[model samples]
Structures are given as C-alpha cells and as structure tokens.
Target: MNRVYILLGANIGDPWQQLAAARLEIEERIGSIELQSSIYESEAWGVTDQPVFLNQVLAVSTAYSAMECLDIALDIERDLGRVRLKKWGSRVIDIDLLYFNEEIINTERLKLPHPYIQERNFTLVPLVEISPQYLHPVLKKINKTLLLESKDTLTVKKHIHEHL
Candidate 1:
C-alpha cells in the first residue's frame, strides 16, 4: 500500500460538517485513514477576502496509484458540492494531495509532495501535528521544521472542538 497524506479544507456551508462527510467518503473510497490531525482555522491563503478555512491533515494507506487517489479526492469534492469558481475562492470543500510515499511527481493534473507544502503554514501546521518528522521529498526537511521556517503570515489556530 502507498502511504498518502491528504489535506482537507472548507470555508463555506458548514465547514465542520463538510470535513466530517469528506472523511467518511475518503475512508469508503480511498483507503483506511491511519492518522488525522486536529482541525485548524486559518485565514484564506491565495485570496484574503474569503472566509477563514477549516483545515486538517490525514494520513492514509491506499493501494491505488497517485492518479487514482486524485480522482477519488476530486469525486469527494464534487460530492460535497464544491464549485471552483475562482482560485482559492470560498468553497464547501477542498481536498489536496500533499504527499505520496516520498515520491515526487509533476504532471499536468497532479503534483506530489505538494509544490507549496513548505510555504503554506495552513498546510504545514496541521501536517506537523500528525507527521512532525515526516521528511519532504524535495526539500529534505521535516514537517515541523518547514512549519517553523514558513514565512506565511496567515493565522492558523487549532480548533478547540474534537468532533471534526
């Protein structure tokens, strides 16, 4: 099985419920969830005018290829009512493939070891919570280290509730 790390985010229409539903869908469609970080609230990344996002990181073990995993994630987003009207626009759900078994892939449709993992604290912080020591395939740095070094000024606070 390939070990995959996925980042989940939502900012519209009951984000907590959307994430919960996405998790269930992932478990049913992708693979078993091995580890999950607490949800985090952060200011919008690419676009600041949008609502704060609820984000979480998940570690999954899957037999599917990376492309297949991406397909499954896209299906989950569509199922959750995601409408990509604009880049980084507010959405009901956004599921990103962060890492895939330490492999680096850059294709038209997918990029493994996510291109911006080192620069976005919204992605790094929760990732650190679950996989602090996990090394970045391209950067050769640990998740926690990357989080500390990240220059992203966006506020990322851990949500107090445990349900999501």
Candidate 2:
C-alpha cells in the first residue's frame, strides 16, 4: 500500500459539513484512513478576498499509485462542487494531495510532495499536527521544523470545528 497525505479544505456552504462529507466519501473510496489532524481555521491563502477556509490533513494507505490517487482526489472535489474558475479560487471543497509516499513523480497534472506544500502555513500546520516528525521526500526536513521557520504568519487556529 502507498502511504499518502491529503489536505482538505472548504469555505462555502456549510464549510465544516462539506469537509466532513468529503472525508466520509474518501473513506468509502480509499479503504481506511490512518490518521487525521484536528480541523483548523485559516485565513484565505492566495486569494485574500475570499472567505476563511477550514483545513485539515489526513494520512491514509491506499492501493492506488500517485497519479491514480490524484484522479480520485479530483473526482471527490468535483463531486463536492469544486469549480475551477481561477487559480486559488474559492470552492465548496478542495482536496489536495500533500505527499504521495517517496515517489517523486511529476506529470502534467500531479506533483509529488505537493509543489506548494512547504510554502503554505495552512497546509504545513495541520500536516505537522498529524505527523510532527514526518520528513519531506525532497526537502529532507521534518514537517514541524519547516512550519517553525516558515515566513507565513497566516493565522492557523486549531479545533476550528468538531469532526463529524
């Protein structure tokens, strides 16, 4: 099984419920979920004019490959009403693959260890909450340490909402 980390976020139409719904759908498709971080309330990252997002990271073991996993993630987002209007646009739900094991596979659609995972505090904060000592495949640094030194001071509040 391939160990994968997925980041979940939502900011529209009962954001917390949408996030939980996505998680339930993921469990049905991906077998079992290993670990999940507490839900966090974070200010919008790129597009500041949008609503604040509720984010969380999850650890799972799956039989699918990296690209296959990406396909599944995208499907879930679409099923949950995520529309691609613009880069960093607001969405009802967003499912991002943060890490896909140690494989460094970069294709037209997917990038391992997510291209921007280390840069955004919203992603890194909850990621470290689940796996504090996890090491990045290419960066070779602990997840928590990266969060500590990150220049992103965006407010990331823990336990923003209770998990369903």
Candidate 3:
C-alpha cells in the first residue's frame, strides 16, 4: 500500500459539510485514512477578497500510484463542486496532494510534497498538527520545522467545531 498526505480546504457553502463529504469520498475511492488533523480556519491565501477557508490534513493508505492519486484527487474535487476559475480561487472543496511517501515528483499536472507546503500557514499548521516529524522530500525538513520557518503572516486558527 502507498501512504499519502492530502490537504482538504473549503470556503463555499457549508464548509463543514463539504469537508465531511470529502472525507467520505476519500475513504471510498482512496484507501483507509490512517490519521487526520483537527480542522483549521484560515484567511484566504492568494486571492484576498474571498471567504476564509476551513482546512484539514489527512494521512491515507492507498493502493494507487502517485499519478493515479492525482487523477482521483482531481475527480474528487470536481465531484465536490470545485470550479477553478482562477489561481487560488475559492471553491466548495479543494483536495491537494501534499506528500506521497517521501517521494518527490514534479510533473506538468502534479507536484508532490506540494510546492507551497512550506510557504503557507494553512498547509503547515495542519501538517504540523498531524505529522510534525514528517519530512519534506525536497526541503529535507520536518513539517514542524517548516511551520516554524514559514514566513506566511496569515492567521490560522484551530477551528472550534460546534458538536450537536
């Protein structure tokens, strides 16, 4: 089985429900989810005028290859109402491939250990939460260290879920 890390983010509609739906779809399409970080809320990364986002990190055990994982991740995003109108645009859901078992891949479609992993608080906060010791394939630094060194000034807060 292949182990992979995925980042989930949403700012449209019922963001909480969107994340829940994403988790369900991931479980059905991908393999079993091994670990998950607590949800976090952060300001919009690139496009500043949009709504804040709810984000989470997941560790999944899958049987698919890196390419297949990307394909499935895109499919999941589309299925969840993601319309890429612009770079860093708001969406109903965004599933990003963060790391694939320490593998480094740079292709036209996907970039493993996501290129922005070390630069964004939204990605780093949850990453440090779940996989503080997980090393970046290219940076050769742990997620905790990456978060510590991140220059991102955005506010990332641990989401307070209202359990009903």
Candidate number achieving the greatest lDDT relative to the actual structure: 1
TM-scores, all candidates, are: 0.98, 0.96, 0.97
Task: Summarize candidate 2's per-residue lDDT along 16-129 as a digit string, tens digits.
Answer: 889888889888886469999889888999889999999989998899887888888899889888899988978899998988877787888888889887789999999998
**What TM-score should be assigned to candidate 2?**
0.96
Better of 2 and 3 by TM-score: 3
TM-score of 3: 0.97
Specify the poorest-scoring 10-residue window by lDDT in model 1: 155-164
lDDT string for model 1 (61-136, tens) is 9999999999999999998899889988999999999999999999999998899999899999999999999999
Instruction: Name the runs in model 2 displaced over 4 angstroms.
Output: 160-164
Cα lDDT, model 2, residue 57 = 93
Q: Give the clashing pairs for model 3.
A: none
lDDT of the candidates, in the order given = 0.94, 0.87, 0.93
What C-alpha lDDT, on a 0 to 100 scale, does residue 146 get in candidate 3? 96
Which tens-of-lDDT digit does each residue in 100-128 have in candidate 3?
99898988998887999999999999989
